[model samples]
Target: MKLWFARVAGVSASQMLMVAVAWQMYDLTNSAWDLGLVGLLQFAPSLLLTLPAGHLIDRLHRGRLLATCMAVQALCALALAGASAQGVATREALLAVSIVLGAVRAFQMPTQQALTPLLVPREVLPRALAFSSVGLQGAVIGAPALGGLLYALGAGVTYFVCTGLFAVAAALCLWLRYAHSAASSEPATWHTLLAGVRHVWHHKVVLGAISLDLFAVLFGGATALLPIFAKDILHVGPWGLGLLRSAPAVGALAMSLALTRWPVRRRTGHTLLAAVAVFGLAMLVFGLSTSFMLSMAALAVSGAADMVSVVIRQTLVQLETPDEMRGRVSAVNSVFIGASNQLGEFESGATAALMGPVGSVLLGGVGTLVVAALWLRLFPALAQRDALVQAGTAEPGGRARA
Candidate 1:
């Protein structure tokens, strides 16, 4: 748990830097497209290196790999700080920093997910995941506001803070004493590397659950446009952007607390769909709202709705997957998650360029609803799942029971 908290702190700090950088980029170019570009650059590493990174995690000491990754992230943060201090934080330089940051996370995120099973007993992993997510949700609640305020002082100050937090996170990784699964003895070969891909491809229920999240969030996410909404749509400043960014986290945190106590134990499939549908509605409401309070409320509701799917999907992925392939499968899952989030930002930016921000957002919300409905038909086994634990007991490499 200490390790989890420390890593969460690092992730939160990185998120803070990201928020400030997005604000800075928009301030520099005053273009929503650039904000989207920042996300695209950050996620490119996931697209390019995550599969390999996942392979490495399975074949290496995940804790040590995480420590190395965190240290590298710190250097990237320090470099960004230097660039800002030198008055050389051009859009291109910032983008370059984002590319490095993205690559580091590409290696870090799967290892992080794979590490969870190592830290706790399998039976209680869902509960542990809920607690683990609290660190993230809490950080989301606080870090954006902190970053916004820090950036208000100076962008360099914000980057320096990130640098320190990442270094601390790196140091914490050294203290983890738990034993993780040993490296796979299989020789490093392309066939072995692609095993994780084949595993997901063959599992209909797992594929369905993952695909549901990928498409819904790919359309429903509106984070990349928050600065635009803060400045133009809501007439709020940087602090307001922070609040806008934090609203969903607040909702997610609250929901996480509730789930920690109750835990989603029944009819998880229906619940997942319902949560996603609510998320879409919230986005639609947020898109049309002129009032800041109303916009925040809508976003908060969306965030809360998103947590249900996150918890359920993550639990399903880890519980159903065999121990030997957790890293590779998680890498695949991260790719889907990264595409949905990063590419969603790009998609939002491109669409915002063609349509107005409000129009683009509205279209995305409607598209999210369409995806939920379509996925319901496309993966009926997933939709009919009754319990998170009992749903995927069959072979992960075989057909899903309908």
Candidate 2:
């Protein structure tokens, strides 16, 4: 629980900084393309380093790696805060901080995820994951809103608060304990580094789940263009932008809590597909709605739907992967997730430049729906999945038999 709390604080701080920086950028340039540039810079580190980072996670103390990453992130936040104090429109400096932040993410994601299972027993994992999801969703819901409020006071204040949050996270991480075998002794060879890539490629269910998110949310970058909506379309101030940014997280948090109360024990695959489709539909509604309240409602609904898939996909990937392979596999997973948000933002920006924000968002929604439908046919194994918890210690392909 201490670890979880620390993570929540750390993430909350990051989210606060994220919204503040994005808002600052949009305000400076008044361009959707520049907003996307923020996402792209954040994406760069993960794209370059995820594979190596995964190998390192499997070969290092995951807890230590995680703690170290948090500390670095705190430094990055501090740097951004320093920059922001100079002026609100510190786009160049904020963008530089993003590059550092991306490097932190590249190392942080897999280490954090791989460390999760080690914190609890196998039987307790699902519940733990559920609670973790709720915590994360809650952070998303509250942090952005808080950050927005802080931004209203001053952008520098928001950045400093974010720095403090990262410090708290790092401190808490020092106390969390776990037992593990010695780090992997394998040489960091090309073949060895690529092992995770091959593993996810061969695991049909894993591949399907990861790919679904990659495309679904990749196109779902409609959320990335939110500064435009808040400033221009909705005419909401920074506070409203924070609220708008947080809507999905609120829905996701509610859904996660419900799942925690009554876990999904059957038709896990079907649930994932249905949830993605619902998410797409909600996005479609969001794109079309003119009223601020209605738009928030649509985004909230979309977030609720997204939580279902996130839980299932995350649980399935972790449970199916071997202990030795978990870090690498998770690293592969991170790339997909990172790309979906950052690259997707870039895509949204490019398309928005051509077709306009509304058109871009609407098209992305349609694309998300199409991906869901196509996935139902493309991944028969994933589609046919039933249970989330395995019956015994079965390998990935043989889990059904177990």
Candidate 3:
């Protein structure tokens, strides 16, 4: 729980910085294309560097790697703060900083996911994952609120607060520990990277589950073009923009906490599909709603429903993957997940450029539903599977299965 708390703090700090950056960028440029460009800057580095970053995670001491990344991120935030304070903040500089931060994130995700099982027992992995998701979602909710408030005070204050938070996170990282093994001592190379890809491709359940969420979220990604919705359609300012960004996180947090008591059990496949379908419907609702309250509510609903898909997909990845292979497999998974976010931004940006933001979002919702329908037809075996948990099947170290 202590480690989880620290993770929450760190994640919240990062997210708050993101919200501040997005708002500041939009305010400075007053363009939807600029909004998408921020995402693009972040995406390119993660997409390009993920494999090497993941490999390094497996090879290095995870605790040290994480601390270094946090330190770098803190410095980056401080730079942004300085730029903002001087009235020299430019969109180009923000994009450059975003790229550096994205490179840091490329290394962050795999190391974090690979380290989870080490902290908690495998049996409670699902619960732990749920809690972790809660932390992330909670940050989504809180960061933007705090960020908007800070922005109201001044952009410099927002960036300063973000820098301070990053420093706090770095200090907190010193308290979290991981149990290393012979597996982590292996060499990192191109050959090893290829092996990881092969492992993921051969594993049907992992491939199917990751692909499922990737496709669904990729097509229905509305968050990418939020600036347009906030300014034009919803007629709200920075505070309202923060609220719109946070609505999904609120819904996701509610669902994550609820799942602690009633864990997802039987018909896992069907449940995943159902949750995604609901997400699509919520997206459609969000796309159509012009009222600020209604649009935020719609986004919140979409977020809550999407949490179901996230838990199932994450649980499957943890439970199915072997410890020795966790880093590599997760790296492959990162590509898909990262692409879903980055490419989705590109898709939204390109589409919005052509056919207005509202139409682009509506079409994305339609695409999400269509993909879900096709998935249901293709993976019937997944739909028919019982609980993801198996009684006698423990992990390699006699630990209970995730």
Candidate 4:
């Protein structure tokens, strides 16, 4: 219960912080290229540190690590608040903070992912994950709208509110307790560092699941261009940007609640592919729509589709992995997630710079559709997968039975 609330507060704080940073960056330079740079900077540290961080997570107490990450984020928020108050908040400063966030998230994300399975029984994990998403999507829904309203007061105020939320989340994490295993004493080595990578490579279903998200979202993500749309294309202010950002989460929250009540039981693989296709279609709608309501509707549909994919992929990964390897496997999974999100933002920004925001988004939507089609051919194992958990599971070192 503490862990769940911690997730909600932590996610809310992070979303608010991101809203402020993206808006501030756009305000500073008014360049789509610079907006892309913000995402690139964040992704760089995660790219470098996430694998090693995953290894450490397997070796240490995960709850403590998560608390520490939250504390560090609080400090980051404080720093941003101070900068904004003193009128020294610049693009360079924002980029530097992005690096710190990336570094912290390298540990935070996989730790959070790895921690959940420990808290719930395997049989209930799918429902737990769906329930978890209920909180997350709620945070994602409300925080942006609140943050946008707060931004109207001032950026400094928004940062201070984020600081407070992080502090609260950190406190909650400190109270979290779970079963701990300290048995693995293997020394760090190249082979150990790459264990997660090798594990995913051997598990074709897992590989397909993660990589499908990577390429599909890499091409389909339009988040980086939201500021451009809010300002130039949609002609809505920060308030509207908040709503646009919240739109997807609104759909996601509703879908997550439904999933919690009635989880996906069959046709899991085909359902996953179809959800991605729906996400692509929604992106196309969002790219073409000039009406605010239409765009919101499209983003909402995309979010609902994404919620289905997330629940299935996360459940599949957690169920297949042993406890000892969960951190490392989740780390690899986080890398894929981070790539799809942070790197995707960079891709969106670069493409937007070249062809304009609408063109970039339209092209990405098409590319997402293409990737989904190609993946069905490329990973037949994933395509043919019948259940989230197979009847006969392989050992830790063997191929995952599909």
TM-score against native, each model: 0.96, 0.96, 0.94, 0.97
lDDT of 2 by residue, 1-402 (tens): 777898899889888988998898887888888888888888988989988998998888776788888999888778767766776446687688878888889888887778777766676577778899899989999999999999998788998888888888888877776665776677899998999899899889999998999999988657678989888889899999999989999999999899898888899889999999998999888888889999999999999998888888888788878878888889999999999988889888888888888999999999999999999999999998998887763233111110
Tens digit per residue, CA lDDT, model 1, 43-153: 888789966887898888777888898899889889888988888888898888878888887888788877787666666778888888788899998999888888888
Name the candidate that leads on lDDT. Answer: 4
Candidate 4: tens digits of C-alpha lDDT, residues 171-221: 988887777777488988999889888888999988999999999889999
- Location of the lowest summed lDDT over 10 successive residues in candidate 4: 393-402
Q: Rate the local accuracy (lDDT) of all candidates.
A: 0.85, 0.85, 0.78, 0.90
Q: lDDT tens string, model 3, 100-152?
A: 98788787777677767666777787888888888889988988878777788
Ranking by TM-score: 4, 2, 1, 3
TM-score of 2: 0.96
Which candidate's TM-score is highest?
Answer: 4
lDDT for residue 55 in candidate 1, whole number 0-100? 87
Give the poorly placed runs of model 1, Cα more than 4 Å off. Answer: 391-402
Cα deviation of 47, candidate 2, in Å: 1.3
Residue 23 displacement (Å), model 2? 0.4
Model 4: which residue pairs collide? none
